[model samples]
Target chain A: MLIHFHVNGKACAVDAAPDEKLLDTLREKLQITSVKRGCENGDCGACTVLLDGRPVASCIFLTVKARNHSIQTIEAFGEPGHLHPLQEKFRAHGAFQCGFCAPGVTLSAISLLNQNPTPTEEEVRRAISGNLCRCSGYVQIVEAIMDYVEERRAAREEL
Target chain B: MAAMIYPHDSCGVSGATSVFLKVDSDGSAVLYSGLSDVGQGSKTALSQLAAEILGIPMDKITFIAGDTHTTPYDEGTGASRTTFFCGHCVKEACEKARTQLFEAAGRMLGVPSPEKFYIQDGVIYLKTFPECHVSVAEAAHASERIYGHPILASATFSSFSTPADPETGHALMFERHTFGTQIAEVDVDIDTGEIDVLKLAAVHSCGTVINPNLVEGQIYGGVHMGLGQALMEEMLEREDGSVVSNTFSEYHILTAADMPGVMLSGMVERPVEDGPFGAGGMSEGAPSPTAPAVGNAVADALGIRFTSLPLTPERILTALKAKQSSQRS
Candidate 1:
């Protein structure tokens, strides 16, 4: 089957199996190694990606369902030497350890910040509830997000 | 079941690790080692050690880790030994390079003795005449040009020794020992048997802290893993030996919402004479006491004693019901 989707702001068309998951299409076909395959049941959230601005687990999301939709991965956020605010904060705060779950966790944070630019600590925790990080214990992850939110708000006030 | 605290210590054993250092003519250094950084920040921590000892900025050092063909042998990156064992090797290698650079710099400046010179921030200067100095790049270039070899040094560390007592095995089982304590505060519902951990406090003594941020990151990660083992994680096997609960959804780990409301951590820095920068192994120690601490907290909440793991709602409800029935009878 042929599926057409915009990945990382680039138009991509690939041939995939009928039962192939979007994770496979992204990783195997498009060679987006950042979309890891931690748990194929949409549980670990290691393969989270933005589908039309909503975070979805790519492991269970079928490639066929993503036709004509805009998909985003961690690669879309920032390039080498240029990092997104969330990525920058995550690095600064030491929010990641093993980094196996980084791309998914980063995308989930992006989704949360996109919807609610300003979120309380509890709200931030709830927003990333679906994503599981085993390495950093989520403390620094939450702190990084909160710091990013505060910095953005401060920038807005200056404007 | 009893609201008792269990205190324990574990030995850290690291054996025969090697690190290779090569100083380029440009004053930059490359470190090659078999240690792998599985998100534990060994690269950053090890590089920091090299930079600090070599008197160069961290960015001036490049680390090549876990390469079999290029790097030397390592026992692997577990048992919290990367920082303790590999750290010593990296430090020694860098120290050797520093000594070599000082020797070359002394000759370049026409100084009689290398002791008259000291290095700071990649510059080797004479104590008496500070203005007469040589950059690390210049020293390396002069040494390689004269000696006909790149400035290179390597060190291997083997701290583990064989146990003397054959039966009891009492002879220095580990190279170092680390101590820690973890306390968990939980809110339990008698009816639903649900437990919500409100907060957690962890106090650890892991010798010297190389990086405070990395240490805290390790503690948080360790606590989270311990929570999973205490309240939710389990591996089930059938009568035929078929395993279940193999997936993350079925084998649940703590999510962001499930984490404690507050997590506080503290460190005690008692430098070990042999440890790198007075730092001992701490990565594995963080998860050791969390489960028991949470268990004891649950026992405190309910006077009833439950000796099983996970403290799942089903088990908690069953225990409560048993207690009620026994009371009625």
Candidate 2:
């Protein structure tokens, strides 16, 4: 089956195998390198990406189901000189090491923030519960996202 | 960028994925580096070192660490090697530039040994002459012209390993190894036999603290893995060594609900007589204390020593039954 969708705001088309995981299409065919390989069974959210602006583990998603949805990979988040505030906050707050799980973490945090612009620390942890970080523990990652939420909330109040 | 000063507006937006630095004809310097963003804050830490050495603001540096073929060779950034090793090389490269600042100052001053010369705020000055303040790029260019050369120094650093004695496991390489302690607190449900990690505490000494936030994260990650090994995750096999419990339904990791409050504590970062930044590796701690910490915690909670990992409900009940029989005997 041929499927067309918006990936990172760009139109994308791919031939789909019904049972193929969305992760295979993005990493193997499209060559978006940010979504990493950890546990293929989706236990580790290392392969998380945004599906229609919500975070989902690409490893478990069926490629055929992505027909008209919006997908976002780490490559689309931002680049040098133009970074998403979450990435900046993560860096400033020291939210990563080895960085194997960074892309997934970044996506998961963004997903949480998208659903609830103002989230408590516990909420943030629950939102990112599916993902596993092999380094930096989860303390800093949680701190980084919490910092972003607080700062964003303050900025929103100013507006 | 290496010394990126992220505006609050771009809080979640990560861009400019690369960096580098350059020196102008004047006394200004710039840095370029790929922002691998190792989460140890290599870019910020490296820029701090450059600014410390080159007498420039950390923001004056730029970096590019993302596109591997374009920027430089990084082995995907693992094993806690970024700070002690990579930062050492970056510092040395800046020193090479510092050397030129001295050489230029030396030729004009007719002074000896600019190696000891100091620069502050992009102004080269001799401690011997407090009145003389000169721009760095000016001095560098002048020295290049007078000495008939251009000085652009680049460096790549490789991390080394230890020479440990096979018998005793004692050795020396990059300073010394780090030691960490993990304590687990758990409670097993009598009916369900589900073990719960009530609390986890870890104390680690991985040399100097480059970033406390990063260190805390490392501790949390380690304890979480320990939690998984204790109650949920297992690489199980059949009696014939065939695979079972192969999927997420069986092989489990800790969820937010399964975790307890983590307490991070420890110290061990003062530099020995040797070492890059007096820092050691952190990779080992994530897996080392995990099993033991949870094992001891399970014992504390259940009053039974676990002979094997992953104290699943069935296993706990079995052990409990055995304990009951022994008590009756």
Candidate 3:
């Protein structure tokens, strides 16, 4: 089967097996290394990606089902020289240590801020609850998200 | 609380060195080592040490590590010894390279004593006559031209070895000891037998914080692992010894929602005698005290002691029922 979708603001087309996971297509076919394969099941959010502006685990999601949907990976953010605000904040706050789970966590946070721009600390915790980071407990990660939100608000107020 | 000391066994023989320094004609240097990062930030810490000792900017140093074909033998990265043991090797290697650089700079500057010269920001200069100087690139080029090889130096380090006593099986086991104390506050529901950790506070000493951010990250991760052991993590096996609970859903780890509301941590920066830059190993020792602290807190909350791991709801209820039945009897 041939499937066409938009990835990271670019149109992409790939031939897919009916049972092939989106994670495989993105990593193997398209060469997007950010969509890591942590757990094949939906338990670990390491393979999370945005489908139609909402976060979903790509490892469990079939590529055939993603036709016409907009898929977003960490690459949608900034690259090496140009970093997204979330990535910048994450680095500044030391949110990630091993950085294996950073892509999924960052996307989940993007989805969170997209829905609720100003969330409480508890809300922030719940937003990224699905992603798992073995290194750097969720303390700094949550703080980074909260700090980004606060900084955005302050910037908006100045405007 | 029972007093216990668990000997750290993994990092005993761990070692790494800048086996070679290939100084390009441009003065840039590439350092080779076998220490693998594995996300513990050993690369950054070791690189910082090298940069400090070499008197070169961090950008000027390229660290090559974790490949057997390119790097030397390392005991591997575990036991929290990368920064302590491997760092010592890096320090020594950089010092050796520094000496070579000074020697070359002395001959070029016509100085009899190389000690009278110093290197800063990759530039070697006379301390007495600051006007006369040679860049590290120039020094390397001059040394290679005169000595017929690139400027290279290497060093290996091993901590003091204490032979174990055969009778009691105890020796001066570890090269250095890292100490930590953690306090956990939990809320236990009497009716539901649920335990919710409200806060966690950890005060630890790993000796002379190399990177404060990285150290704090290790502490946070350690507490999370300890929470898993204390509350909900378990590995189950059947009669034939086949494993169950193999997946993340079955074998649960702490999530953001499960995290405590407040995490308070502090460090005691007491430098160890033989450690590199007076630093000791930390990550492995961070989780040691957490389970006991949380268990004690739960006992304080419920007025009963539960001896098994995970402290599951069913276990808590079973312990409560046994207590009640005993009181009735």
**Top lDDT hit:** 1
Query: What are the models' TM-scores?
Result: 0.95, 0.74, 0.95
Task: Rank the models by DockQ, top first.
Answer: 1, 3, 2
Candidate 2 ranges beyond 4 A from true positions: A10-21, A27-31, A74-77, A155-159, B1-47, B57-100, B128-131, B149-177, B231-233, B238-250, B255-258, B265-269, B277-287
lDDT by residue (tens digit), candidate 2, B222-277: 66776677667789899999879876657776655456755454545655223345
lDDT accuracy of residue A78 in candidate 3: 72
- Report the lDDT tens digits of candidate 1 across residue range B86-130: 899999999999888888898888885877887889998998999
Model 1 residue A119 lDDT?
86
Ranking of predictions according to lDDT: 1, 3, 2
DockQ (CA atoms), all models = 0.87, 0.36, 0.83
Candidate lDDT values, in order: 0.86, 0.69, 0.84
DockQ of 3: 0.83
Error of 3 at B252 (Å): 0.2
Number of the top DockQ candidate: 1
Candidate 3 chain B lDDT trough over 10 residues, lowest sum: B1-10
Docking class of 2: acceptable
Cα lDDT, model 2, residue B284: 43
Lowest summed lDDT window (length 10), candidate 1 chain B: B1-10
